[model samples]
Target chain A: MAARPADTPRGRVPRAEREQQMLDAAVLVFSRRGFHHANMDEIAELSGVSKPMVYAYLGTKEELFIACLRRESARLVAGLAAAADPTLPPDQQLWRGLKGFFEFVGAHRDGWSVLYRQARTQQPFSVEVAAMRESVVEVITDRLDAALRLEGRQVKPDDLTAMALTLVGASESLADWLADHPDEDPGRTATRLMNAVWLGADQLMRGVSWRPPA
Target chain B: MAARPADTPRGRVPRAEREQQMLDAAVLVFSRRGFHHANMDEIAELSGVSKPMVYAYLGTKEELFIACLRRESARLVAGLAAAADPTLPPDQQLWRGLKGFFEFVGAHRDGWSVLYRQARTQQPFSVEVAAMRESVVEVITDRLDAALRLEGRQVKPDDLTAMALTLVGASESLADWLADHPDEDPGRTATRLMNAVWLGADQLMRGVSWRPPA
Candidate 1:
């Protein structure tokens, strides 16, 4: 997908369109060559834009990588938000949301490696990734709160955060596993986690407990 | 806890004891100063050993940090192993393991921060941290397999992995939160996760699924 200038004349292409091409190029290059080995010169060439233009538009390689991280994470967050419809029952909403999230990760294995493997552990970028994660957590907490309210039940803020953290944490751990195992089905993972979590949460909320089998 | 030389002769102390002292100082310094800002001179000074002695015992700052990570993770792993007495039933075993883990994290919040927050996302060290986490996963998986066998039941390896991943990932996420909230009880965190996971696994094994509330 080397810089296709939106069917417009090359020189007259809109700045926004041109910038997107550069970003596309950067994402592909970074994902393939890794952040350190990925060269700006190649990114500029692949995007069909000049080096100075790439710089003027996107700053340095670090800034460009951050841009890629932001775009990819935003795409993920948006997908999750759209998947959980308010009209649906709480359990359906959760199930759909998990399915959608896993599908997105399954489809974008390359994007995940760059965002999670590289950006998550590296400096400055890790902060960005953390902020992104916090947003996802907030979305989950809000949905849980809303779902419980629909049942005319209320949970303490701390308990809600605990529940959200469990979901987010378990999803991330499995997501990392999903990226590693190409043979694994993304939907199955979602189902596995849903089974592991939602059912347990429902049971716990109903005061169900598991004891040692005597 | 600045370097307490044993009551016996200083230079006459055994190599193993000396190394332990150095490791103790390194863990303290790394936890307080972080990886990038931590220096060897301070660690040596704190441990009551010379800077050169630290170099001889540990290779470099990177190696020292790795050593610290290894020791801390080992302590955690051992605590978990010791807590989950196999003589107990499966749920009890799991509950004990999780409680032990969260209690360790709560007690050594600084060690948790260094081992998790810093080592997990940073390079070279991230790989070390992952290896440590894998060992933990193995421990959890093995216990799960044992527990099932006692019940005269068997599970597929992949299913066991998924179950272990859920527990490890959820615990790590909550542990991070636990470190942040000093007021939070470690025992409660363990109980919360057990309710979120173990009960769910027990139900799923019984072929139960959570449906939308009508």
Candidate 2:
């Protein structure tokens, strides 16, 4: 029988592959136990490596967590980027992006919690996650800007940024809601957001505004 | 000079007033240190009372945290309710509600953190905080539903709920953003959200939606 590559003893396992394995374990532990309660020993055991190896490769728990965050965040960003087609109109682009976001979150529930909830709570990782969130807001803002220009409606830069932030925040909150209610459809959730934000944004683009009654 | 009643020492201080002082200290300490790290001893010292007095008034650390959460959450709810006048049209009601929300959050930044950010992070308090969030969602949903009906538009209950959740979530994220960027005006932040959500909601009520171009 041929020897299985994955079954090879610890020292023989490639560094990159081993690192990936450790991270996979780390995500599960951190998601389940949170950053403070999660420990290295369990992560090592789950990764089929020893404690010493985890420390040697990943440095500290904080670094390991950051690595997990970066990995998961990159995956999400990559997923959204791949799904968003610049050639498409801004609404379609947004729809695709929202769909991709929900699908990624639904598929990677643990990753979603770790990146969105757990990382957000802990101080050390908040800045890292905030940067990732800012990039997302920037992407959405750019899309909105292009869309507005296409309609020949020029909005203030700050207004555009604020609108983008609200959209991102709304989507994130709905995504968390979706996570909690396992049976809910992500597509439907995405559609609901689209209906709520995009429709309003469309009206604003056309100069239709809702104001307080006199 | 007559000794101030509050300075008459712990045993003589009015129980209700003492409780409020302890909660004030708890909010500060909890917001600063988070739930797990916050201790009753510091809260007591900060409140100008003994640790036993804190225990007598607020109970265990978990109970005290919950007390702090309840007190802060109640203040916010009261502030919003007081600002929302039922006689006003729906948009204005929302505008006022949003204004009230931002003002409350802006004024009670520490309380906002304790209620929204800090309480949400820990396991024991998440459920408690979530219930508070649901009530807020419920209030918004009712407002949205009333507005839609008044416009003679009919929408699914679930869709209305989802929209309300999105609005609430968006406001929360922006409020956090407001917390970080202290220079930003809360009124403007409220206006920005109103422009994004209320306009979008208004369009949806009028049966206008943005769809991808063919």
Candidate achieving the largest TM-score:
1
DockQ each: 0.44, 0.36
- The per-prediction tally of clashing pairs is 1, 1
Q: In model 1, which residue pairs have backbone atoms overlapping below 3 Å? A: A121-B121
lDDT of 1 by residue, B45-164 (tens): 988888998999898999988988888888889999999899985667777898899999999899898767999889988899889999999999899888777766677898778878
For model 2, name the residue pairs that clash. A200-B200
**Candidate 1 structure quality by residue, lDDT tens digits, A1-214:** 5765446566787889888889999999998999999999999999987799899999999999998988888888899899889988676788788888888889888878776679988998899999999999999999888877776677789877888899899998999899889999888898778767866633432434332112
Best candidate (score: DockQ): 1
| Poorest lDDT segment (10 consecutive residues) of candidate 2 chain B | B205-214
RMSD of 1: 6.0
Q: Candidate 1, which segments miss by more than 4 Å at Cα?
A: A1-8, A201-214, B1-8, B200-214
